[model samples]
Target chain A: MNSGRRQFIGRGGAMLAGLAIAPGMLLYDLAHGRPASGAVRWGMLIDTSRCESGCDDCVKACNKENGLSGGTGPADVQWIRKLELKDSRTGRGVSLPMMCQHCEEPPCVDVCPTAASFKRADGIVLVDRHLCIGCRYCMMACPYKARSFVHEPVHDQKPDVPRGKGTVESCTLCVQRVDRGETTACAEACAKAGHKAILFGNLNDPGSEISRRIKAVASTQIRADLGLNPGLHYEGL
Target chain B: MDLLQARRDTRIFYLLVGLGALVVAAGLVAAHYMEEYGHIVTGMNNQIVWGMPHVFAIFMIVAASGVLNVASIGSVFGKPPYKTRAPLSGLLSIALLAGGLSVLMLDLGRPERIIVAATHFNPTSVFAWNVFLYSGLFAFVGIYLWTMMEKRMNPWSRPAGLLVFVWRIILTTGTGMIFALLVARQAYGTAILPPMFIVMSFAWGLAVFYIVQAAMYGWNEMELNPAILKRLKNLLGLFILSVIYLVAVYHVTNFARHAAFERFILAEGGIYPMLFWGGYVFLGSVLPLFLIYFPRLGGKHHVLVASMLVISGSFCLLYVLIIGGQAFPLSIFPGYEARSSFGDGQIGSYAPSLPEILLGCGGLGVSFLITTIGVRALNFMPRDENTQAGD
Candidate 1:
């Protein structure tokens, strides 16, 4: 090929590449390097009676969105799991998903040696992957069994949901989606499944749907006596 | 002068050094594999996050704090008999701490990132405070050793020893609080854990000192002079009793409210109950007490055996506390029968893998190596009035 033709092709490719990346650059600006605000507290509420015992769309959706392996093994990581409670005498069973109950006074945050386990300004508890030394103190301190240490080498991780070996992890209330003014993957899946069991909203806003529902019903926070003041709520025994 | 080394069989010293090196190398290899493969290669899972490595690490750290009791008595309390053994006491403290801290750092999922612990200070974190507490122990004990060894610095030994004695008490409290302050598990969450650990350290640390002192004396074809043996054994007996009392209080206090949890440890939980009764309560506590306090069992030989039993019991006791405490499921569903595929409300089972055990043994190897080298190179041999003034 002639030098002029080759140069023209290369220039065209460069322009195409820049065109492809311009949207991402704008999105990065859209991300705007903004800080999580303390004024906005993200939360969830679950109506157990609407949740089906056999259905686990939330778990599947979480695995798919978070790039988890979806294995139920002793060593496998579970951002969320179905916990079934059975009354011994009555044989009445209640099923609900258990996960990180983002608390106002998170025990995990208090015990972390590196301050790797931290609460964002918006009251969403998170582990700073950079600082976490895999001490698992947060795992030990968590009251809800919300955390899981990555036992094996993680492969095919979703770019948005970063995970690795040795470090502890848990449900983030789908911070990535929440950051985009979207709801969690689990909540969306639960609603799509027609259960409408999970509710994700801003607890900081008195006008939010979750706030209205919690106020309307006799919803309760699991382990309220611990006084963690969890953002998550549940209704029905 | 060097009864165990210069004039006697240096062959044993080299042999032990070789053995210790081999164990350390094996541990490094095991640690490498764990790091390479992730903790999935080991028995640890989400449920039993802290396992055997923790048992060894905590034992070594606690024993390190307790080992200073010898120096405290000699210098701070101004006991001449203990003064002769002060240097040896300080040396063992450094050795045990180094070993314990090594295992702890290496066991992390991201061991390379351990420096982050120091850089990012979490004021509320007990573990973060321990990073300073543990490092300070090495520094203060090192200074204390210097004061005892350097004739010119003899005047400073008391102040330095007093500082170390205080530091050690705080250090053990930090270690105990690692579990004590943990409210998530049923087995922990009492303020008594700190005191319980301090008392346990007294027994465990003295137990370690006795074993090392015996070996050193035995290597020289000498016996621990019966008078010194009597005083030490009496102290060990008292410490052992204190450990029992504190442990009983911890369990008894749990009975009224946490009865099921207490029963799970005492009887219902299969391996836990067995280890508590057979390994810790009986073998570690009862037998050693019998050996130390029994009228006819006051011989030097009995003390040596008793020390071995005490050390064994230390391992069993720590395993029960660290691993067994973790094995009990969390109280997620407080008042109902809870079940999950994730082992919620289920007794978490963990069997230490070979690599994990080696990683733990490696800590012992490091301790052993340091002691062997320290004794051979320096005047760490206990120089009480009963023995010839080797110095």
Candidate 2:
């Protein structure tokens, strides 16, 4: 009985040691983990034909998800906005949303003095708040007018989307959600509102929904003549 | 001849320094208020991120490079008359740069993170290049000044001056490229901008130098020789004409490629057209040209008036360029007019607030104070052979 008890004690100690080493191995992987591979290129497709006027569901959802409040001043921070367009020649109008195009040759990244503006391996462009000097050169360089300078101090920020005053910001394509294998808030919100206008998927994957849609329909990039090769595309202008 | 030995502790000197100090104090206070309360108090918004502060800062920075031209002429070209003015040119360059850089740093939303700007570099960025150029200018100019002032280092003065001359051109090129490299703005993306800025520095720098030289002469009860005065005025006239030619070519080229931008700047733009025609063309270019070319109407006084007008016009021209460029909506959708909460398809409006004006004036004041102190402590007075002959 004493020998049987000794064996039981030894086995229990071994089990405890194995449990202790498990978390350290997991942490090691976390520390040395590489960024998302270039195999996945995130992109979006918008069908303006299905978009409705006066529907700000995407904007509202983006604000909520990013922890932004409505500001009436000229210097207000807005990551995404709905634009109403009118063609002078035809007198025809359409409503569409405009945000960061996330171009392959982003002018904002090129003009930033501190390398604060950077593009991820997955093609998501972001501004590092710690390094941005608020020179607004990036704002000057953005052709889409997609960037907004944070003129006021921010309070009650979402932990995931950290922002501060004097830093330039733009649409992140819901990078936090994308990392978790979820669709962007703006895309999800549009579908939930029954518009079904925005489509989000990997551009690199031919089997992805965005790729299939692009192959099926003729899509246009805004200011395509600039040769920036933007990730965002629209079906109807 | 050493100015430091001269009795410089006069009531007028103290008065000038005190006034300049007050203006600098006012600017600091305004910058503090802007940073504390947020940029909401100012006219700048998300649409017009850069405002009046940039205009002043750019002018000072450009003029700083240009002001060194007098020294370049002396040391590089071996001009006898300009040799004596080299020390003053060096002093003014340092002063103006300090003032301009101060305003630029103060205007930053995160001024505390300047160390990051200095450390982290983006090779593709024009701004990143400017960081190296700006610091290098200070260091090189400082060395050049030391070489000029120290009798033992006189042998090295010519080489140091040549190096600074080359550096200033590169520096000005970088400054011009700040706008020229912008593919986003229709008014900016031209190769001529760098050369235009180079000529602009020549014109603006000479004007500033003339004004300060006149002030110093007046304080010392000295007469500026007519021969030297004529040479300076003629040089100013030539620079003004070159600027006019460049301006014409820039507009003509822009009109051919970017018709919409040209139309907005030349005709349809509300404040832009007015500022362009009334301020830049009329006051900055034409009036100064007339004042410098035809001296009979105002005689010697006309030179001073022309210089002042030239300076004033530079401000207007920069305002039209910087503010006007941002005011026009971006042509994202070529065929479609855009309307949004962010003021899409609409011209952005800006009105300079009190704080902004004070901040600009403070830069001027800082330069003025430095010039005053520098002239008192250094032998910056121009002593031409002709003046000495008269004596």
Candidate 3:
């Protein structure tokens, strides 16, 4: 019995040692080869008071730009949305545009098993469609419920945008538009109205409108207590 | 081959597999149609973003993890009744894991790429560690069970089983930490989640075992020992008490401060209150306790019924936790209502679409089908070897 137990212990130790080695090896390579770096920090400032509840122009613009229908369905994706709200006590109604807040310390990035959900050097929280396993832990970990899983098979999937079933997706902060040195679709739409409810700039840059407004007003980060330090700021209480 | 036993087992296995396959196919077809039509097929939307599938998946995973408790008692502690029941306990652990993983795969958008999760390594991610832990734990249990099958148990079996036990606890912690560590979310943050998971695990694990044992025994197989049943019931009873205590403390402390979290979960108008009362407290925790502890009851079938109730309640617990956490909006905009941002002065609504349900259900079918087939092929349940000779 003693020998049997000893042998079991030894074998178990060996198995665990093997598991430990695999992760250790990966960490070594990551540390040596491709250390995380700084890139562009895509930040947004949304003045909720400026948003119109009746017109989903931002949602429409995003859908059109991303080849989506402004339809309400699981597969009918929403990159940007206008959500209605009412006063908690008095019951007065208003609308707020809901999208990915793109946190500097993103929970999705912290929970992804495949490193598919990552924060770009420039501070944009994005998902690598190719690498994403669609485990939805990132979705679960995301405090805002900002992430959505593509539950159905995709039809007419654009070549440029590789959306698929069994994968999670959310606001990419318009990576495609950013790649082209352009403003986000929603930001562009908000810009057209000259209300500037949506402001885009480098969060790191002090002179940027986002940074300036963040400094100028008593701006708040939604779920600020979460400690996610979201790059997106909402101004005007 | 005792043609009778072989034939009976084969027939049962085939029937289960066939039925599972048919349901899976039907679900897939429905899912395909729903996806094509859009997410309107099921009862979920932004308000109630989580529904039956989410509930089912969490239950399965919790149930899967719970199976380990029995295995640990028998294999690790070497206690009476539990020691004799090691082989059966081990087999049940694998079976429950199958059920859990199945739900996960179907719940996913890209279940096919699950393999990639194993291949890619993300150091900073808790979910990444979870995938690794889950794989290792499963492999260890599988091998340990295989080792125990031979008339001469392999020297490796005990240690492998022990490792699985330790790893499973860690895995359960990781699962809980997925919520508790979310400092960003108001609903979950207490240090109690890990211990809560542990308590929940034992309750869920014992409940599943009770039901499985009853089914395996048929109407009157009588293979299960009365002593074992008594011990298991006692342990389960203890777990129920712990679960109640922990839940009370978690809520009471949060409520004392009148925190938004407390208001969200306990207040009359909030979704948190509705789900906590409707799902977790009454269904999962309270009723099961009554069934387990009440007088002149807690017999085999009663225990089985109680276990089923616990399982159902546990599923609801996960549902309430996952969905309820997301119901509150992150932004605290000025001149806006505090709660209305979640939806139109209501909680965010969600229902699992057909594809989501199909995939979730398919995961269950797959888990059952796999366990049924694996047990038949791989000698999962331990044989007496020499029943006439006492240990």
Candidate 1 residue-wise lDDT at B61 = 93
Clash totals in order: 0, 0, 25
Model 1, docking class: medium
Name the 10 consecutive residues with the lowest summed lDDT in model 1 chain B.
Answer: B382-391
Which pairs clash (backbone N, Cα, C closer than 3 Å) in model 2? none
For B226-269, candidate 3 gives per-residue lDDT tens digits of 54556667778788778878877877875664366567666653
Mark the 10 consecutive residues where model 1 chain A has the least summed lDDT.
A23-32
Ten contiguous residues minimizing lDDT sum, candidate 2 chain B: B382-391
lDDT of 2 by residue, B146-230 (tens): 9988999999999999999999999999999999998768889889999999999999998999999888888777887786778
Task: Report the first chain's TM-score for all candidates.
Answer: 0.86, 0.86, 0.79
Which regions in candidate 3 have their CA more than 4 angstroms from the true location? A1-40, A46-57, A72-75, A83-98, A148-166, A206-218, B1-40, B46-50, B151-155, B256-292, B324-335, B338-345, B352-361, B370-391
**Model 3 steric clash total:** 25
Evaluate candidate 3 and give its CAPRI docking class based on DockQ.
Answer: acceptable
TM-score of candidate 2 versus the correct structure, residues matched by position: 0.93
Q: Which candidate, 1 or 3, has the higher DockQ? A: 1
Candidates ranked by lDDT: 1, 2, 3
Task: Return the candidate ranking by TM-score, descending.
Answer: 1, 2, 3
